[model samples]
Target: MSSSPATRRMSASQRIIVDITDWNRFLFAGKPISGVHRITLGLLRAWKKLGLPFEIIRHDPETNRHKIISHRFIEEDFSEPIHIGGGRIEYSYNKYVQRRTRYFTELAKAKLRRFVKKKEVVHEDFIEGNYEPQADDLLYFCGAGWDAPETMHAAHKWKAQHPGFRFVVLVHDFIPLINKVYRNRLGTRQFRRWFRDAARSADEFICISDNTQADFMLHWRRCGGQGVPRCRVVTNPHEFLSVSDTRNQPMSNGELSAETFLANRNRRYLLTVGTLSSHKNLERLLSAWNTLNFFRDPEADLVIVGDNDPRDVRSLSPIRRNVFLFQKPPDDILKLLYMNAFCSIFPSLYEGWGLPVGESLWFGKVCLCSKSSSIPEVGQDMCPYFDPYSTEEILLALTNALFEKDYIPSYEKRIDRGRMKSWATYGSEIHTALLKMT
Candidate 1:
């Protein structure tokens, strides 16, 4: 026998289309590719490996016009135009905004136009009843948000028109749930509406963690939007490590290996990795570390690996001289740091899913994480947990994880758990889920 088939069989399957917005880049100027993108690419690769025929479609907003450009990745062709209004003019007025917007917008629109013009035009608007889906085609929307209500409405309409086709949506975060308190300029009503519509329309909702899925469910119930699509928890997959490649390549930006950096600096220190944002609670971590005398040793360093936010710097003046802040290091260096660090400290106020906790465990690093949100889920008992709200609690945890000579529980359990949850295992789970969906 070949194997057991898990995915549900469709009545008349034509082709699978995996769609995403901003598929080219990862989380908010962090990297061209990242954890989510890696999983997406991995899924595509897995489909190909299994000989599953599918097409990848990416819809990017056109900078100059009120439209969106769609490309068919499998055919290397572009499809019909999707009219989505652009907000370039309004965005350009903000002086603090990065200048790369114009360049990126123009480049995306040009590339999309060229690709579409070269391919057979499908001018039918699935959203506006310009075209109807055939029994064979299925559309999977990944990392889509409520910000585009029209897209969701269109997908729902198309699904209704073609009952045989599958339409799935992947929810990356419950942003409104945790970020509602920080609604300064972004209208709270608008954000809530987007979340409501997304929960209502999606056929299948893919959540990055069980905690996220539960949060969505709770919010949906509270909003009286029951009977939403089935929410499934799928842990994001990390790139499989190649021992040889990691060994051969320079870990840092060719500056210094994390091991070497730590060796020269000091043996005792608490490390944190993330962009310097309010949610990260970096200042609190620093205050706690200072109070505990965790880094009293003159050589000890509290190294942070991420870009510092100017807003945060302004709010918390007199930046500590001992706190070494480096612009985001490359992945290899990060992995090396996790492998060698005395302890990894993450005191985020909230997280949809704590990636660093899982990552630190994967590298066998003792991690000190906050009990808030999904951090506990990611860290479990493998990490030494702390109350993010209490400076004293965090300080105590930090002190023990760093100075205790026999602090081996966290490290041992991290290695054990990391070994159990490899990328291959994550891929297998996804493969099974996709198969079941079919």
Candidate 2:
């Protein structure tokens, strides 16, 4: 018996190129803000640490083409042109004028899809004709969503034409459709279709979590799809280091310690950090917090540090009295908050990997997360769990966590656990996974 061609090809040094269509300046044109952006930055840092010979190809809106900005030493390169819709503008804004402008821009861009497709064809032809004279050169497609259809198509075409190359798709999450919270977005359907196509076409699939891999398998089965690539769950890495020097660090930028923020000199407070979105189940958390009488106790303040989604801004009005929501804060301040807080509460209804769960644990702070999606896989037993749907259960859990005087874990135990789960270890795991793929 012998292994298949795919298995044989995996054992070699290869030049890898990752396509990031929705990253960095592209996602945040005006300001550097967004969870995805921050996460992407962390991943890039980790990739650099791995010392892999790879390049990042990003879509440039001005040129309507993918350009390699990071690694430029390669001789043969193909720039894929991507067709983007104006729907983002409409989805992001609500005013009539803004909507009209967005609609028109989208319509115009939609009409230019054929042109973009042609440019991609030309680029592929140039690569095939000029560069890939040898057969061993491999190209890997890495990304989650359907935002880069052109690059995906190019990868597929190149793989078919140059049978030696390998293509891999990165699966982030399958909740955009299955989860009712985000069903309204038309782009979700487009992304799903693209994901299916890319998954089927790729030589392998890289899943961010085991939960995501299971969800993707279920999705593929539901759609009567077959021949999907083998998937390997590789958790995203958090490369941020703990600040060694927190002495005299100013927490005065509206970012206060858990003790001061709670307005109680003696009692502990619960904390949650993430965007204020419907899927986050903040309303339920707030309802539970209110029931626990956190505000009156003067010892418990539910400090939320993240920007609020404009659509859900009004939903937060009723809970505004007790909940302290900071739009944005520096990473140092956030790290300090995580360290000082009694516990970090993450009641998200769904998540791809639940970065905060690991992050909180990394800081030696206990986490209270819902036993839903990928949270349990990340939190384990170190952090308490709660049923996200049941407000009463959440309330009970919070009360026990805060009011019970003897419920605290030993400080030495926490430090021991935190030492075992640092970002360096995470980065090493990811590096090993990439090496296996090569």
- lDDT tens digits, residue span 334-428, model 2: 67677778888898888887877777777777788899988877766676788988998888778877777655574215434533444445545
Per residue, candidate 1 scores C-alpha lDDT tens digits across 64-119 of 21122223232211111122222111111111122358646755666677577675
Candidates in order have lDDT scores of 0.57, 0.58
Cα misplacement distance, residue 437 of candidate 2 (Å): 3.2
Tell me each candidate's TM-score.
Answer: 0.71, 0.74
CA RMSD of each candidate after superposition: 8.2, 8.3
* Candidate 1: residue 72 Cα off by (Å): 12
